[model samples]
Target: MKKFTLSFLLIIVGFINAQAQDFQGMAVYESKTSTSDLKSRFEGNKDITPEMRKMIEDRMKGMFEKTFILNFDKITSTYKEEEKLDAPGQQQSQFGGGVKMMASMMGGGGTFYKNIKDKNYVVDKEFMGKEFLVKDSLPKLNWKMESETRQIGGYNCFKATAVRPVSKSDLRNIKFKNDKKDAAKTESKEKTTSIMEELEMPENITITAWYTPEIPVSQGPENYWGLPGLILEANDGKTTILCSKIVLNPKDKAVIKAPTNGKVISQKEYDETVVKKMEEIRKMNSGRNGNGMPMRMP
Candidate 1:
C-alpha cells in the first residue's frame, strides 16, 4: 500500500512537472570524431583559415569531455577513442592511417577524472601516445571571482568569472625572442621572436561554473569548477564548456570523494618554477635544432 501510494504521488508529480512551464529533458552531448591526413610538423606555422582554427578549437574542446554516464552519485569516465581507432579491424580513414589524429595529438590514449571532494573538479588533459599526466594549474583566486545564476541540466547553477594570470613558465614557452642578437644567434631564435611582447592572455575569461548546493561536490571538468552542486560550463576568455546532456536519480547508488597526488603548488611557485625551467630548456636547445625541432624516429 505504501509503495503504491508513493508511486501514485510520483506519477502525479511528474504530470504536474510536465506542465511546469518547461519540459524536463536530459542533457545530451554529441560529437563526431573524424580524421584527416597528417600534415607536416609546421602545420601551425602556415596561414590559417577560420575553418581550420575552428576545427582545432573543436578538437581541443572535445579533449575535455567524456562519453561515460553519470548519475547523482557514483560516476565513471572512459575514453572510447582508443578502442574505436586502435581496433585491429578498423579501416583506414586518411592516407592509409587507421589511427585517430586527435589521439596522436596527445601521444597514445588518455583518461579523465573528477575530484572526490568537488564532483565538478576535473584535471588537465593528456593525449594519444603520451604517458605523462597533464594537470590543470590550480586557480590563484587572489584576483577575483564573481558569480551569476542560471539553469542547466534541469537544475539552478551559479555562473562565475575570474582572471587567470599566465604563469611565467607559460610566458616563457609562449615563443618570443629574449633580445636582438647576432646573425648566428638569430637562426636559433627563430621560434623566440620579440614581436609578441604586447600580447596579454585575454580577460573576463568567463568560467560559467554551475552550482546547486544540493550536491555539495567541488569538482568540474579540467580543473575548472568546485561550486556546490556541479559545474556544466567553464570558459576562459576564449574557450567554453556547455552541457549538452545530463542525467539524475539513476537506479544505482553513487559514492563521491576527492582526489589527491598532483603537481600541487602555489600559483606563484608554479610560475617561478615553470618559467625557470622553460628558460633553461630554451637556452640549451638554441644551437641544437637537430634535437629541438620535431622529427620522426624509429
Candidate 2:
C-alpha cells in the first residue's frame, strides 16, 4: 500500500485534537434542597416562637441553596463548592457546628477529587475545625438507562436511574415520636425507647439523573459519576444538583488538582471519628442545661 500523504495525516491529527478539547472544560452547577423538613423539625421544639422559626427557616433555605464548580480534563476532575457569602443571615448559619455536619451529610460540605481512569477518589472534609482527607474508591452506582430524555440548559440529556442505600441517621428526619396506637398499647418506657432506636439496615433510595453524551466526560457534582456523559441534573431523594452553565476550553483552563493537606484517613475511620467526637460532647454536656432549652456543644 502507498504511504499516506502529509496533508491527510495532518487533517486526522487535527480531528483527534478537536475531540480532546471537547472533554476539557469547567461546569457550574446550582444545588438546591428543600428545607421544609428541617423547618418542621425546628418548629416542633416548643421553645421556638413562630417568628424565630421563620427566621431559622429563611436561614436554612440560604444554606440549602449552593453553587458548585466541577473542573475536569479527560479522566480527572475536582469538584468543590464556590465559597460565597450573600447575606448576614446566611453567614451566621454557615458557621454553626450542626449546620456544618448537616451539610457534610448532604454531600455539600467538601471538595471531591475523582479519577475515572483509576476509579478512586479523595474527599477533603472539615469537622469542628479539624480537617480530614478521606481517601476511598469511587462509589459504584448501578445505573439503569431509561428511554426518557430532556433538555437542560440547551443540552439534550438522557434519563438514568439508580438505587442507593441510605442510613436512617443520614436522613434529615429521624422519627422519635410514636403513633397513638403504639403509645397506648405500650406504656413501658424501655419498650418505647427501644422502638425509637436508629435503624440498622439502610433505607433504599431511588436516584434519577439526566446526562448528555455530547460531553463525553463521566463526571458529575458530589460523588456522582459513572454515566455515559456529563450529568446535567441529578436528584437523590434528599437534594438536587443541576448544571447551570458549561464553558468548554475556556481562555483560562481550569486547574484539576486534588487537595493535598489534611489528616489522612479512610472513609470508615472518618465516620468513627465524627461519632466519637459527638459522643464526647454529649457526655460533657449531660445534665448541665435545664428548662428544655436547646443547647449546642462547643
Candidate 3:
C-alpha cells in the first residue's frame, strides 16, 4: 500500500510539474533580403540600359523559381519556458478572491536558444582550396542585437536587437551571368565594377526582441534571444517580424538539424575565397579594361 501510494504521489507531482512548465511556442523568423531593391543594367558601353535590367530581373526570377530553392528542414528549434507562483489566498483559499501571480520568462518574460535558423539558406561553401557541396544551413551574415525595451500584452518587456548586412562578396564570387545573360556583356570590367560597388550594404538590419526572466531559457528562433520579455518583433531594418501566434509549451516534441548541402569554411577562409574570386572576375572583365565603374547601380 505504501509503495502504491508513493507511485501515485510521484505521478501527481509529475503532472503538476508538467502543468507548471512553460508553453512550447512556435518559432518564426522574418528576414529581409535586398534582392528587390537594386537594379543591375548591362549596356554595350559602361552600363546596361533600364530595358536590359528588366530582362535580367525577369530571367533571374525564373532561375530562382527553378534552382534557388529554400528548404526549411534544416533549422527550426528553440526553448521558451515561463513560470509562476500561486498566491495563498488566490490559489488555496476556497472563499478568497485572489489570483495566482506569474513570474517572468528568460528571467521573468522570455526564452533563449543557441543557434536557430530563421531562414533555411543553403550555401555552396568553398573554402581553403576545399569546396563543400551544399546544405540547408544558417548562413552567418551580419546579425546585431541591442538592449532596448518595449511593452506588449500589458507586460513591460526589455528589448534586444539584431542586425544583418548584405556584403558585395556574393556578386564577386558567383557569376550570375549563366548561359542566357550575354556572357560577353556580363564579363565587362566596367559593368562588374559598377555592380559590385552598388551592392555595398546600404544599412544595418536591426532586430528588436523582448524577453522576461520568468522563463529561464536562453534560446529563441534563429539564434536570437537575451531580453527581459517575449520577443514579439524581430526587424531586419526593412521588414518587421512579429509573432502572430505563439504557444507557451506544446504536448509534442520538436526537431532541429544542421544543413549539409552547403560548404563549411572558417571566417578567414570565406574572406580569402571571396576576395580571390572577386579579383579573378574583375580581371576577366574584357570590356571595361580594368578601369572600374561608379559604385552606384544605375
Candidate 4:
C-alpha cells in the first residue's frame, strides 16, 4: 500500500509540472519611430514653412509612437495595439486625418494572429471605412543569429538580423522630392513647392532583433516571429519596438483567436483592393482647381 501511494503521488506531481509548462505569456512593447529623416525631406523646400513643418512632425510623432501587447503560447500568438483614451478637448486635426488616411492605405491598424504549428496567420485590417480579414501563410524570415548578447527586462537576449521586403505604400518609406523648375512655373512657388510632387519608396529594409532563450518560445511583437526564443526587442532603420513588461501565466489569460468579423480575403487580395481604391481616389481628385492650378490630393 505504501509503494502504491508513493507512485500515485509521483504521477500527480508530473501532471502538475506538465500543466505549468503549458502556460501562456503576455508582453508589453513600446514602439517608436524616428522622424528626423522624414523631416529632412521637406528641408530646403520653399513650400513648407517652419511652423507648418513643426506641425507635420508633431503629427507624425503622435501617429508612430504607440504601445502594443503580445499574447503568446507555445505555437500561437496575437499582437495588437493597446487602446488609450485621448485627452479632453482633443480633436483630430487635418494633419491627423491625413496621417490616418495614409495609415489605412498601409493597413496600419490590425490585430495580427500567428500560428507557428500551422505556419499561417490572420490579420484584421480596416481600410477606407471597410474591414478585411486577411488570411495568409507566415512569411519565412531567414534570420542570421550573432554572438552578441544583452540584457532586456531581466532576460539575456541574443541578437539576430534579417532582411525583408518593404511595401511600396509604407509610410516609413515616403520621401519628398522637390523640383525647383516646377515651382518656378507656378505663381505661388511656395505653395507649389510645398505640394509633394514625388514620393520615393525603398524596396527593402533590414531588421535587427534580440531574442531571449529564457522564455523558450517563438514569438515577437508585430509580424515578427520564427525566432528560436521570444523576441524582446526589434528595430528597423525607422522604427523600434522594445519589450517593456512581461507577465507569465496571469490569472486572466488572453484569448488567442483569429478575428472573424471582417470580409475574408487573402493578403494579395487585400493589397490589390487598397491599390485600386487609391487609384480611384487619385482619379477623382485629379484636374485643376478653380484657379486653374493642379489640385493636390490630400
Candidate 5:
C-alpha cells in the first residue's frame, strides 16, 4: 500500500515537471487611463468650446480603455490589441476632423514582440497603408524593489518601481500648432494656445509595477518586462494595465512568432520616416489652407 502511494506521488511530480518544461501561456490585460486630471487643467479655457471639449473627451475616453493579449513562452512573447467594436454611435468617423487628425498624428495600434533570450524585439506598425517593422533592442528598466505586495488574478505579486526621464520630443501631446488667428485673439500668447499643450520642460516619470514569481517568466503586456517574474500590473501615472485572466499550457500550442510583413527598419529610421511624413502632410495642409500655416483646434 505504501509503495503504491509513493509511485502515485512520483508520477504526479513527473507530470508537473514535464508541464513546466513545455510551459506556454496566454495573459489577457485590460488597460484603463484617466484623463480627468488632464481635462481639469484645460477645462476652464475659453478658446476651447464645450463641443470641442466633449469631442476631445470622448476621444480620450476611447484611448484610455483598451484590451490586449499577451501570448508568451518561457523566453519570448507577443503582445497585440484585440479587435473590439466601438461604443454605440461612437464610431471613428463621428469624431471631429481635428480629433481624427490628432489620432492619425498620434499613430495607430502596434504589435510588440520581445525575446528575453535574444535581448531584442520587433514592433509592427502601419502608417498610411504602408507597413513598417521596427527592430530594436529590448528596453532596459532599472527597478527598485519594494516591500509592498498584493494579489492580482489569484497570484501574489510584489511591487517594484522605476523612474524614467523622458524628453519633450518623446511626448505626443506636447506640441501645439501656432495659429495666427489664436495668436491675435488673446492677450496672453500662452493662454490662447491649445490647452492640451505642455508648456513646461520634460521631466522624469515614475512607473510602478506588480509581478508574480509563480509564472517564472520575463513577460508582460506592451514593452514592460524585467523583473524576477511575470508582470501582472503596471501603472505609469497616466495609464494602468492589469492582467485579468491567465491561461497556462493552453490546449492549442501558441506559435510565438515575430512579424515579418513590412519594410524592415531600425527604430531610429522608423522615427525619422514618421517625422518626414508628418512634415510633408503639414506642408500640404498648409498649402491648401492658403496661409502657409495650418490652423489647429485650440
Candidate 6:
C-alpha cells in the first residue's frame, strides 16, 4: 500500500509540473508619444493661430495615446490595440481621416503576432482601406543587459538596451521648415511656397526595455521580444510603452494566434507598396490647390 501511494503522489506532482510549464499571460500596456517636437514646429508661425495650434496638438494627442493588449504563452504572442470610442464632436473633424492614416502608417492599429519558436512574425496592417498580411523574420535586436533593475507592476525587472534603425517614411521624422528666405526665393522663382520638409533621420535610435523574469516568457508589446524574460516596458526615444496590468494564467485564456485574413505580402514588399502609393498621390496633388484645382504656375 505504501508503494502504491508513493507512485500516485509522483504522478500527481508530474501532472502539476506539466500544467505549470504551459504558462500563459495577458499584459495591458499604455503607449504614448512625445509631441514636444510637433509643438515646436508650430511655434513662431504667424499663419497658425494659437487656437489652431491647440487643435492640432489635441488631434496629435488623440492619435498617439493608445492602449494595447498582449496575449502570450510560451513561444507565441499577439499584440493589438484596444478599441475606444472617440470623443464627442472629435470624430467629425476634417483632420480625423488624415490622422488615422498617419497612425496606421506608424503601426498604430493592427494585429501583430510573433512566434519566437519559429523566429518569425505576421502583422495584419490596414493602409488606405487596403488590408495586408506582412510576414517576415523577426527583427533581431542585439540587447545589452544592464545591471539596473526596477519594479513594474510589482515585478522586478532588469534593463536591456539596443539600437534600431529608424524608418525614413515614419511621420515622426517629418518637420516643418519655415524657411522664410527659401520660401521667398521659391515664390519669386517657381510661384510656390515650401513650408514643410522631411527631416533627415539618423541611421539608428537606441531602445531601452525592462523585462521581468517572474513571467518567464519571451513576449512584449508591439515588435519587441527575445529578452531573457517578459518585457514590461520599452522606450524608443519618441514613444514609450509600459505595462499597466498583467493577468497570469487567467480563467479565460486568450487565443494567441497569427492573423490570416489579408493580401499576403512580405514586410519589404508592403513598405515598398506604401512608398510607391504615396509617391503617386504626391504627384497627383502637386500644383493643385486644396479644392483640387490646378494652380497657375509661372
For candidate 1, lDDT tens digit of each residue in 174-256? Answer: 22233445545654655663322322333223334455554444445434443544556655433344556665543443443
Candidate 1 global TM-score: 0.44
Worst 10 residues of 3 by lDDT: 98-107
Residue 146 lDDT (model 1): 49
- Tens digit per residue, CA lDDT, model 5, 162-236: 987642323333433445575445337342333443234236777899999999998888777889899999987
lDDT of each residue in 153-258, candidate 3, tens digit only: 4445566645554333333112233344544554563434544333333333445566544443444443344443345555544434444344455456354334
How do all models score by TM-score?
Answer: 0.44, 0.79, 0.43, 0.81, 0.73, 0.84
- Superior by lDDT: candidate 2 or candidate 4: 4
- Model 3 Cα RMSD, 1 decimal: 19.0
Model 2 C-alpha lDDT per residue in residues 1-298, reported as the tens digit of each score: 2356877888999999887855578899998876654455464467877877766666566567888999988788999889866665554653365655656655554679999889888988876676779888887899999999999999999999998765332433233443566644445543223332321323577889999999888988877899989998999766789999999888897778778878998877877776666555554444334332343323
Off by over 4 Å in 4: 1-21, 41-54, 105-107, 177-197, 283-298
Best by lDDT: 6
Query: On a 0 to 1 TM-score scale, where does candidate 3 land against the true structure?
Result: 0.43
Q: Is candidate 3 or candidate 5 better by TM-score?
A: 5
Clashing pairs in 4: 47-194
lDDT at residue 147 of model 1 (Cα atoms): 58
lDDT of 4: 0.77
lDDT by residue (tens digit), candidate 6, 1-298: 9999999999999998888657789999998887776777677778888877777888887777888999998889999999888789887877777677788866474899999989999988877777889899988999999999999989999999999876544555444555677655655643233222223445688999999998888889988998989999999887899999999899998888899988998877887776676655555555446555322211
Clashing pairs in 5: none
| Per-residue error (Å), model 5, residue 207 | 2.0
